[model samples]
Target: MTSVPMIDEILAEFLQSGLGIHVGTRNEQLLPAGCRATAIKVEDDGRHVVVFVPKSAAPAVFENLRTNGRIAVSMARPADDRAAQVKGLMMFSWDANPDEEALARAQWAGFLAQLDGIGLPGIATSSWRVFPCRAVRVKVTAVFNQTPGPDAGAALP
Candidate 1:
């Protein structure tokens, strides 16, 4: 099998920094499902991204990933609105590991802190649970610049 292309340093850092992150998947019937990811872990030199989604809020997304591998994830910086979207194929879905669980909690906290730092109210407290999560690993197949401007939505090389 051909190896996946690695995400560049800038994009990798953006993903790992707990910015405005959302992950989406479609069921076999093409019904869409999405949720805000608690954290995103870049592994294997950025060829793989594992997204942590709450079981409470997105059980349908988890089930969709199981039935169909297609996935789309978007991340943006709240400060600048710079963003990117990745479209990929899910390689695996499983329970979050111990370390992953911890990281997700930390990231989620940091995300809230960032919002507060910018004078925005954080998400509802009840929406921030870290346990009972599913980790969906995706092999990125395409990257696009979602930032507004002349090249908005253009596929990245």
Candidate 2:
């Protein structure tokens, strides 16, 4: 099979920079669920993107994915107000492996640092429950530049 990147290098770099990540889903009844993302990875193939959030933190998201499969993830660097969004169908949702957990920890730390750099400090995360995570994998159907600008909402190539 031929392989193509779901996200190019620039977008990938931006996503890896400890931005604020949020994931979205809807149940069969069209009820929306959202939760902070704990970690993210774009596979080497570049077509599969995996996002992590603790199961305890987002049971509704997982349940929604299982039944509805539609998924959308938004990422942003709030200090600069740059943002992007990806929408796709859920490929799978699973318990995070050991390596995935480590990735989550690293990204969460980076996010904390970013918050501090923006002069916001001591943000409480205890309620986030970002551990013993669940990973949701999505096959990218579309990506958009969500940053506010003249070209905001443009579809990324």
RMSD values for the candidates in order, in angstroms, are 2.3, 1.6
Assess candidate 1 and give its TM-score to the true structure.
0.87
List the global CA lDDT of all models. 0.80, 0.84
lDDT tens digits by residue: candidate 1, 1-157:
7665668777787777867788888887788988887788888566888888777766788778777788898987776778888889999878888888999888777777777777887555455665667888898888899887889899874
Clashing pairs in 2: none
TM-score of each: 0.87, 0.91
The candidate that achieves the highest lDDT relative to the unseen native structure = 2
Query: Which residues of candidate 2, in runs, are more than 4 Å off?
Result: 125-127
lDDT of 2 by residue, 1-157 (tens): 7777879887888887777899998998898999888878887776778988777765788888888789999998857879999899888878999988988888888888888888878784555577888888899889999998899889986
Q: Best-fitting candidate, measured by TM-score?
A: 2
